[model samples]
Target chain A: MNLTDQQRTLIEQIGVWHENNGIQPAAARVMGLMIVSDKRELTFDEITEALSISKSATSNALNLLLRTEHLEYITFPGDRKRYFKMKISNWREAFTRKIDDLTGFNVLLRQVLEVRNRNCDESDEGLQDFISFLDYLHQELPNLLAKWEEQNKKS
Target chain B: MNLTDQQRTLIEQIGVWHENNGIQPAAARVMGLMIVSDKRELTFDEITEALSISKSATSNALNLLLRTEHLEYITFPGDRKRYFKMKISNWREAFTRKIDDLTGFNVLLRQVLEVRNRNCDESDEGLQDFISFLDYLHQELPNLLAKWEEQNKKS
Candidate 1:
């Protein structure tokens, strides 16, 4: 699959952004390519040829993406080869997971507060305020996700 | 500034978490210390001594934290040394800034959609759905933050 210069630039920019966010260069490049591909899906050989990456590199990148739920593969009738595409819902799930993890950490923070209360004088109003903020977020994030789901369903 | 065994374990655990998130170990240690400190404020020497980090490492970590607004310092009347404390509000600001950046990215995605619409057959329902999801988030995230603020005010 030949890429226009503009498409190439966009792919490279996406790759750079993912790399900045700590993804490996090859996997990031694959993700970038997958996002901007006109077909919205590509075979393994096509991905390797388009990105000019080695077979092993392509396989590794694809496997990582699949393991992380960032990409999914499909097979058509009578087609032995698999075709891969971006999993857009996975992006939403990733954000949701981050919020969930923070909420889980709030439980730990509450336990820490109990310990602090037992061990120290109850004078650190700032610490108390911070805990209160975390508690507020813990209660609100689920509702926020629910609201997004409700809006998404309407749209 | 001596730490109990439990405190030491907690600090180390926090440092490991930060390291996994791509933060430097020294800076992560400083963050952990600041969070659990009974004093709520510490001088340069105090941070170094408590964390067992070298003076140069302490300075570098403190400077990074200060630059990122994760920590702030103040000087007392007639005192030459600065006392530093964790900036809990910065954590809130960081979350706010993340939502803002995502909202900003929605504009870029809209442009991408326009270009894609012109260049492609517009058969990619998945792409359109992803864009719609982003648009929903762009509209809804501010309300989530506002709701958090209202709840915080009440509590």
Candidate 2:
């Protein structure tokens, strides 16, 4: 399949950034190929040929995507080759992880604010302003997750 | 200030991961320091001394944090040295970036599913099942974000 230059650039950007952030670039490519392909699940051969990467690279990339739970592997009764398709059932986990990461940061941030406020007498209005926001965010996280889970159950 | 061994190990983990992911280890160190320090903001010398890194390393780390908008610079009128503090005014932005990142992946995943679903003939139940989740995830994202944002606003 032919991709426009803009599409190709976007794929490259996603690949490189994800790689730089400790994820594999080829996984990003496999993701890119599958997303734009006329067919959703692609075999290793198709992916390798499409991305012009080595078969080993394609193999490794696909494996990593599977390992990360972002994609799934499918085997047919009569087919020798395995097929990969995006895993959407676990999307809630992805969102949860995002919230969890922010929550993690907030835990650290709140402690800092607490100590700073306690020691400095809370005279700095800027500090108090930022502190109030952190406190509010920290307090709100659990309710937000509960609400999201409620919505998830409905749909 | 001395960090406990456990705290040091956690800091090291964060530092190494960020470094491998293209962020400088010292940048991660600065982030760690700010998170745990009694004072939220730190001067260049304080960061250097606290992290046991060089002044230049502290400067570079602080600059990286500034670029990411994770931390900001502060100036007191009488003091020539710059102070840096974590930007906690909008914790939602940090979480939102994660949502945006997922959106990027979701968009690509949806495209792949569309293409592959088309190629899977009526008899190919396995391939169709393999990609079904992508469509579901694409549909859920808008509602998820709206709920999260609504909670964020209420908080």
Candidate 3:
């Protein structure tokens, strides 16, 4: 489907945000388009035209997105084209990983603490404090997720 | 102070991790060195030699890390040389921003929902559901942080 001016503008805005977050430009725009496009699913050609991107670029971006679980595909009974759709539901895993990564440093922080000289007591204590703080966050995330889900069900 | 083989290896590991997260290589290594070093602080020449990085590259990385608040500098009464130190304390704020950025999408999500064609029901509802999920997370973060702090005090 052809995009409206508003849709095109929104795509760029979303695209820029994703690109700044380290996603390559083509892949970022493709994801932005999938979210903003009116159609629930798009053929490979539709994605290419919507973003005005090259075929190889679109193919590469699609592969990256699919591999990353941001997008998924389906084939119809008689259709030769693959329909790509958003797998945003999987974002809970992605978002959870982002939060977990905060606490994930505990492992390395411990490693860091292990090798420090005993004379660097202050900073060593600082590292230990940070580790406990991260451990607290890690333990508490499940509680937060449960709370978010519980509230989500209510509303 | 010269970095030990163990320290150098740790620096490389930490530097690689930071670089994967989009930090420039020189800046990443410099930050890693500051964290793993035995000294609480390092001077300009020291950072350069320790990293075996060029003067210009070291200078740029120092400026980047200092500006980003990951490192800070000090001046001594008699010493002309500046001593740069770790500011890992500021990371809590950085981590807070990371959490906030997940929910930060609500503003843009609402905008995306606003302009979508009414017929695009499934994806629109999907976006709406995602927004509310994010809203729940946003509302609940402070409570999680408070809980973490509370638990930290008990232990």
The best candidate by DockQ is 3
**Tens-digit lDDT track for model 1 on B1-155?**
87777677677776766665557899998987877666777999999999998999999999998988889998999999999988866766877766666665555455455444334555555566666766666666667667766876776
Q: Is candidate 1 or candidate 2 better by lDDT?
A: 1
Among all windows of 10 consecutive residues in model 1 chain B, the one with the lowest summed lDDT is: B111-120
Error (Å) of candidate 2 at residue B98 is: 4.3
Please estimate how well model 1 matches the true structure, expressed as its whole-model Cα lDDT. 0.75
How far is each candidate from the true structure, as Cα RMSD in Å? Answer: 3.0, 6.1, 1.7
User: Which one is best on TM-score?
Assistant: 3
Model 3, A13-40: lDDT tens digits are 8888788677889999988898888877
What DockQ results do all the predictions give, each relative to the true complex? Answer: 0.34, 0.25, 0.58
What is candidate 2's lDDT per residue for B60-154, written digit by digit as tens? 87887998997987899999988888785544476456556655655554443343435445524333333344344445545555554566566
For residues A29-57, could you state the per-residue lDDT of candidate 1 as single tens digits? 99888877767789999999999999999
- How many clashes show up per model? 0, 8, 0
Relative to the real complex, the DockQ score for model 1 comes to 0.34
TM match of model 3 to true structure: 0.94
Task: Report the poorest 10 consecutive residues by lDDT, candidate 3 chain A.
Answer: A99-108
DockQ of 2: 0.25
lDDT of 2 by residue, A1-155 (tens): 56656556556665665665567678877776665555667788888887899989988988888888878979999899888887745555764565565456445444444443335555344444444554555455556555545654675
Query: Where's the lowest-lDDT run of ten residues in candidate 2 chain A?
Result: A109-118
